[model samples]
Target: MTTANLPDLHDLRERTRQFAQARDWEQFHTPKNLAMALSVEVAELAEHFQWLQTGAATELDDGKRTAIRHELADVLLYLVQLADKMQVDLHAAAVEKMALNAIKYPADTVRGDARKYNEY
Candidate 1:
């Protein structure tokens, strides 16, 4: 779906919270557990590209793309739940991180380079 049609992060967070509450699953959604689940979801997402070269990966069939989409949704859901449990504003944190990254890896200096900030 397009960004304009999507629910804001706060709404998504509340919806996720209600989902867990309805299922009585909030007790299992501690930061640590959510983090582990998020990691597992990431691994599952990566599995789709495990054997494919970078160029070939971009040419995945519709089924693989659908699977990747679901995996991505799972990742986002887990992250939203984790952020709720931790009382962190995901949007704000992401913005702050981008600002920090800019300072750590200035575009002009880091252009065409993939090295870490210190490595450059």
Candidate 2:
């Protein structure tokens, strides 16, 4: 779908839930399984750029880009499923984490640095 027409996170989560429910797949969608699946998908996504130099990944052709997109969708689906099963609101969790990160890595101190928060 186009960027403007993409489904919202809640809608996507609902749809993913329905898809799993319809397939009686919830038994197989435990947080551990979903997390593992998410990790695999992330690895697959990383494979696309494994040997590429900086800025090369963004130069992928349409087919490679499409593959990357599908890999990302897979990662998101598993992450959403895992969060839903754990009764977590993904958006809220992300916002809260960002807030904590902002505190841990204040711009004035962390800007242009790649060190861990503890090191900063």
Candidate 3:
């Protein structure tokens, strides 16, 4: 379905559940496997920019942009699917994780610093 016509997260999760069940794929979608798949999709997404010239990369035509967008959506879909499979609230988890990161790397302390979080 088009993203503009996409269902809410709960509905999306249910749809994914039904899809997986129909194909008997739920057993194959273990957390570890799903996580690995997500990582692979992310790598593929990154590959789109492997060696493009600075200006050329940003000047992608409609078709190129659409391809990149599809790759990005693939990555995100797998991510959300994984989260749903694990019964984790993706949005809440993201917000909570970012909150923890903020404490771990307070902007004032790390503003101009180039150190890792542990070093900060």
Of the candidates shown, which would achieve the greatest TM-score relative to the real structure?
A: 1
Per-prediction count of colliding residue pairs? 0, 0, 0
Model 2: what TM-score?
0.88
Give the RMSD in angstroms, all C-alphas superposed, for model 3.
3.9
How do the candidates rank by lDDT, highest first?
1, 2, 3
Candidate 1 on 1-120: residue-level lDDT in tens? 654466689778878988889999988999999999999999999998887878275679989989999999999999999998889999999999999999999999999999999997
The CA lDDT at 31 in model 3 is: 91
lDDT of each: 0.90, 0.87, 0.82
Better of 2 and 3 by lDDT: 2
> Which residue pairs does candidate 2 place in steric collision?
none
Model 1 residue 119 CA deviation in Å: 0.8
lDDT of 2 by residue, 1-120 (tens): 543465587777888988999999989998898999999999999998776775275678788888989998999888888888899998899999999999999999989999999985
Q: Model 2: residues >4 Å from true position, as ranges?
A: 1-7, 55-58
Q: State every prediction's TM-score relative to the real structure.
A: 0.90, 0.88, 0.78
Name the lDDT of candidate 3: 0.82
Better of 1 and 3 by TM-score: 1
